[model samples]
Structure formats: C-alpha cells, structure tokens
Target: MVSPQVTNLAIILVMMQVSKQVPFDNPDVLLGVRALYILSNLIILGIYLYIQGKINKKRDMTTLKYVEPAPVGSGEEPRPVTTTVMEYDKQQLRQLIKTQMMGVGMMGVMHLYFKYTNPLLIQSIIPLKSALEGNLVKIHLFGKPAVGDLQRPFKAPQGLFGMGQGAVKSDKASVENAEKNWRGGVKEE
Candidate 1:
C-alpha cells in the first residue's frame, strides 16, 4: 500500500502529463491544464522538501566553479574580478542544497498557487499594457546588469518563471537578504 503522500504524488504526476496532452480551446480545459501544472509544481516541491529532509541526514556536496564576473569598470577596456571560494564538505553541501531547494521550491509552489487561485492577481499586478512599453518596466522585466549586465528581454510564457521570481524578490527583496534571511528563498541569483 502506498502512503497518502506517494499516492497523491502519483496522481499529480499523471495529471501533469495528461495536462500536456489536453487541447486548450475551452476555458474549462485551460483552467484544468493550469490546475494540473500547479499540481505538478506542488508535487515536485513536496517531493523536493521530503527529499531535502532526508538529504539533510546524509552527505550532499556542491562544487562551485568560477563563473565569469559581471563586467566592471568604465572606459573602453574592462577587467574581470573573481571571488575566492573553498571546497565545502559533502554533508555541509547537502545541507545547503537541501535548504536552498526547499526554500525555492516551496516559494515557487506558493507563487504559482496564488496565480492559479486568483485570476485578478496578475491583472491587478501588471500595470497598463502601455506601461510595459516604457524602459523602466522593460528593464524591470528584462533587467539591466550593473556590472556584467547580460539580462535578455523576456518572451511571453517562457518568461513567466522570471516574472514569478521577481514577485518572490519583491516579497523578500535582495538576493543576499533572501539567502541569509528568508526561511524559503533560492540562493540562485
């Protein structure tokens, strides 16, 4: 016999896959599809949280490679600045990953859940369509990197995740703030 969690997980997964196959002409069908998508996120998040706790009891290693820094300085020539990092132990890494995973996944679940439940949330949130035409709104949506600026213009449904993450940011604010502060916030910035 499957535990309630496991059964629910299965249902969520099946619905998620089925939602992909469904046509989206009818509003009811579209709503169902949206619901399944939300359900999939919740299940994924639930499983992530479940595994996160278990992972906490074991070793979880994270290897951070030096990524290119945001371009800094002015004038024609620019230089790169790299930060020093150390190798974290497996257990410590796992704990960190677990903590981060649960934080991000849970917040993501909540964000999508709210949108799915409340139609007015997006409508009320997004300013006038004309407002989006301004550089300010576009910059908010696309973003301008201060140092190594490289954010791209968001494209429709593909950009939804970024939009959702932005909402998450407004609730919490800074990336550093999110990392050290929030009970459930992603370390990915």
Candidate 2:
C-alpha cells in the first residue's frame, strides 16, 4: 500500500546505501544486465499493446449504453437517464497506448542511467516498475481485478516496534470496501 513516490524514494535511499557499501566497477556486466532489462521490458510492452489492440477492436464493434439515476431534489422523485458511453474509442485507445509507450521509454532510460551510475539502485526499482506495468496492463487490457489495498494513503506505523494494531484494522476495513467497489461501483442518486 505504499505510495509510488514513497516507494521510489525508499528505493533510491536503499540504492545509495547499498552502492556505498558494495561498489561495482564492472561496466561490461552492467551493460549486459541493462540490455537484458530493456529487452524484457520491451517484450512485455509489445504484448500489452497487442492485447489492448484486440480488446479495443472488440469494444469498438459494440455500441454500449446504460441508464443512470438522475439526481433528485429533496421533494422530487428520482428519474432514470440514459447515457451513451464510448468505453474505448479509437482516439482514446490510441492515446492510452501512446502514453504507456512513453512510460516504458522513460523507464528504460532511467533504469539504464541508474545501472551505469549505481548498479544496485536499478535492482530495487525494476520490480516496482514491472509490477506497475503489469497492473496497468491488467486493468486496461485484461480487465483483471486491481490490488485495492493501495487506493488509500498509507498511515505511519505506530506502536511498540512500529507494529500498530489500530492502523492494521482500519487499513483492512478500507481494503475490503475498496475491493467491494473495484469496478466502478453503482452510483446512487
């Protein structure tokens, strides 16, 4: 449930500490590893885009509309309103794909730079980046359930040894509610 910014910051701090402790001077190994990472990311990105294309094709062939309840005044009765929603228009889909491609490109650049400067830093960030990309692909292309536990802001750990029971309980409840409403829950007027 850690925020991405916080997680990134922690990764950088750990990388700095580890780099100081274990200095790596082998450029050949770093380059090899960086190349492998970039190749793997590109492969995954290609697959994600392919799947998204298929999904968008299917969506574009369909016309979807739904009825939503209109807001009612204190003394009025609720009325249902029909709304037409283009879930995956061609332009929007293209834009989404472009954005994801840009993200992958940026990740590749950052990772390669970090690998050369501080080899240890790239290790921590790679898994985080992969998980984020996987989540993005899942939600957009595969229609898979998201990890609802991360929707809320993280509470500072509080207790003896920083293992707080109150925070755990609240976090658990919030996660449950989030899971229940994961797929754009029903709107109440």
Candidate 3:
C-alpha cells in the first residue's frame, strides 16, 4: 500500500507536470488562479490557528500536581504543594503562538510573491504549508509543551565532525608544532 505522504507527493508532482504543459497566456486566468491559491492558504491559516487555540485552551485547563517533600527526619507523609495546581505558562503559550504566526506570515508573503512570477515555485512550498498548518513545524521550532519530550531547546549531538575526545587540543598541538617547525626552518635560513 502506498503511504499517504507518497501519494500526496505524487499528486503534487502530477499537478505540477500538468500545469507546466498548460500555457498561462490569459492574464485573467493567471490572476484567478493566484487568488484561489491565496484564498486557500488563508483558509488553511485560519483553521491552523483555530486548532492551535483549541489545543492551547485544552492545555491551559490541565493542572500540574505537585507533592511536597517530607520534612527532614520527621517521616511525615508528603502533602500536596497547594490546593490549586499550576496552569500552563501563559507567556510560553503566547511566545509559541507568536512564533507560529511569524512563520505563517513569512510563508504567506513568499507564496503571494511567487504565485505571480513563478507559479511552479509555489508548488515547492506545499510541504512547508502542510507542515505549518499541521503544527508539526511549530513544535520543533518553538519548543512548545515545555515539559515533554518535544520541549524546546534541542541540544546538538556530540561527536559531530569527529570533534570529540580532545580533538581540539590535538589540533592546537599540531598547529603549534607546525608553527615551531616553520620558525625553526626560518632561523636556520
């Protein structure tokens, strides 16, 4: 069975191929197509924002339960930190939404610009549009949910480019040795 992603990609490719064959000689047709594309993107953006709002509301309604540590040497059972649980941080949510909106605005502008001069270029943005609308891009970009596995501030993996295990020190030593050799040759001359 073909995966949905593959199917979607294939469909897009076919559409692009078909569009390339058709001559867009009529300015009215081109304008209409551009308008339709922009309208579709606007609708998608609206739906995406709506879904994010709903998700944020649901998340805000959630409570974080905290248990107090037992007193030292008392062995008393720990009590709840407070009767009320903390809601999701409003500032973080606002930042996340802001980031998403920025991405939407940027993409919208690019799409609008490209749809007129280069309709084919607009096709390249389909995946980005889908990802943005689905909120997948936001999670990675904004680090939303702040506490879960998908939390923000991803760390770069170690050992990139073979830089692990005192590689920098060794490189410095090698460079110093080479410099000394060059200086020694100059002195001999």
The models' CA-based lDDT, in order, is 0.36, 0.47, 0.46
Residues 1-189, model 2: lDDT tens digits:
654556666777777787675434677856665565566556655765666666555553433222222233344222222222224333334654576567656665765565444543454355436445443445555565534632212232344345433332233444444344435555345
Query: Per-residue CA lDDT of candidate 1, range 30-139, in tens?
Result: 56645654554455445444444443443323322222212334322111112211222223335434654565465456546653333222222122222333232233
Please give the range of 10 consecutive residues that has the lowest summed lDDT in model 3: 162-171
Error of 1 at 48 (Å): 1.6
What is candidate 3's CA lDDT for residue 133?
29
Identify the leading candidate in terms of TM-score.
2
Task: For candidate 3, write residues 40-104 as lDDT tens digits.
Answer: 55665565565556555545444333333345567544333222211323333455456556655
Name the top lDDT candidate.
Answer: 2
The parts of candidate 2 lying over 4 Å away from their true place are 19-24, 60-116, 119-136, 140-142, 145-189
Estimate the lDDT of model 3: 0.46
**Model 2 TM-score (2 dp):** 0.42
Can you give the TM-score per candidate against the true fold? Answer: 0.25, 0.42, 0.39
TM-score-best of 1 and 3: 3
List clash counts for every candidate, in order: 3, 0, 0
Q: Give the Cα-based TM-score of candidate 3 against the true structure.
A: 0.39
